[model samples]
Target: MPVIEVDGLVKRYRDVTAVDDVSLHVEQGQIYALLGLNGAGKTTLIRMLLGMITPTAGSVSVLGAAVTAGARSAWARTGYLVEAPVAYPELTVRENLELVRRLRRLPGGTDEVIERLALAPYAERRARTLSLGNLQRLALAKALIHAPDLLILDEPVNGLDPAGVVEIRTLLAGLAHQHGTTVLLSSHLLAEVARLATRIGILHHGRLLAEQHADQLDQHRRRHLHLGTRDDTAAERVLQAHGYHPHPAPGGGLQLTDEHALARPDQVATVLVQAGVPPTRLLTEEEDLEAYFLRIVGADHG
Candidate 1:
């Protein structure tokens, strides 16, 4: 059974649709990421999935239980972190986690989660005294204290340093790979999620533009062969005469989009060599995730 299922989900506030007709399913142990920029409805969609907000149309099923207000199907087995991390400012880190432990009726694990998130150093310190990064860590620790079967995080890496980001990435990966946990996270950082999420869905202006597996992401990105020679004019002339289309690259090189060049770079090299304009540099350049995202979004509107 899928861990999360959304069918024709839609949310709107007086004509301003926050989430369009979006449908997706997350299987067990799969890390699905909702990728979009700010005001792209990622948070709205997440809120609907968590039963925090109601959708105008369609349905949401989490852990095989239909989600409805005051009737969460698997509340005990789910963990989530929404928009901004909030906590009792005066409560110490340990006290806050202890509250969660008792409220959830859990047996133990407050200390284990604190250590796991590297918050032991500030365990006794008040939440208000911790830095932004450390406060974010405490939020994550609360979500992980019970080791819930499903974890839903929004912009999970917000307010963390480079090292802390790496740590969180490793922890989530381990949780999914070693233990059987399903994750659905939202972030605008396409490049970062490209490396972490098993599957990705692109959202723009309250609509889902595209969805693809991480391994198959390369198929959606554009690729071209780059060629550079000592004599740029001669190389361009030779390429055109040989029926090859060449465009100037942004960084003082020539880019070739011809299928023949990309499929057989060796042939392209031989052609240049025979013309006495041997390429000084020949390499394939694939578009990055950010560029691909902008291109697709622009194409949708353009």
Candidate 2:
């Protein structure tokens, strides 16, 4: 059974429809990423899933339990960090986590998560003294203190540096792979999400435009062969004679999107060289997550 499920979920605020008939499911041990631009309703959808807000239509289920406001049973096994991290100004890092533990009725324990999130160095420091990155780490520590089965995070890496980003990425991967924790997160970081998530869902204008496996992302994106030769005219002729449809690249090079040509670039090089117009450069380029995202969004708008 799926770990989290949403069916025909919709959220409306007066005249604006924040979420429009959205539906998705996250399986156990899967890192599901919801990607979107600003005002794409990602946060709204997450709020509904967490039972922070009631959906205008449809329903949400987590761990086989329906999500409703003030429902503590379903939330016991869930951890979340929404928008920005906040902490008591006067409390130390350890004190903050200890307070959360008590509130959750969890047994006495704050050291494990402090070490897990690399917050031990600042354990005695006041929350107000922590940097943005360390503050994020502290929030994550709270989420993980209970060792919850599912995690829902929004912009979890907002204040993290490069190294911190990688650290959290590895941590999340380990959680899903080794501990069978299901994760559902929303972020504008497309490339980062591409690297970490097992499945991806694209949201635009309050609607889910596409959903696909991370491994299959490249398959859905465009790829092309870029070729540069000493003699452009001769190279074009050579390519035409070989029945390859080549188009002019932005920088006066020839480009071909034919799958056969991309797969057999060496053959194209041989053909060009034999024709006395040896290629100066031959390479294959595939669209990255950002470009793929723009293309999809543009196509939808067009």
Task: Tell me the tens digit of each residue's lDDT in model 1 across 180-235.
Answer: 89999999888889888999999999999999999898888899999899987888
Best candidate (score: TM-score): 2
Report how far residue 231 has shifted in candidate 1, in Å: 4.1
lDDT of 2 by residue, 264-291 (tens): 9999998888889999999999887788
Model 2: weakest 10-residue lDDT segment is: 293-302
Error of 2 at 81 (Å): 0.6
Model 1, clash count?
0
TM-score per candidate, chains pooled: 0.94, 0.95
Top lDDT hit: 2
Model 1 Cα shift for residue 107 (angstroms) = 0.8
Candidate 1 wrongly placed segments (more than 4 Å):
299-302
lDDT of each: 0.92, 0.92
Model 2 lDDT, full chain set: 0.92
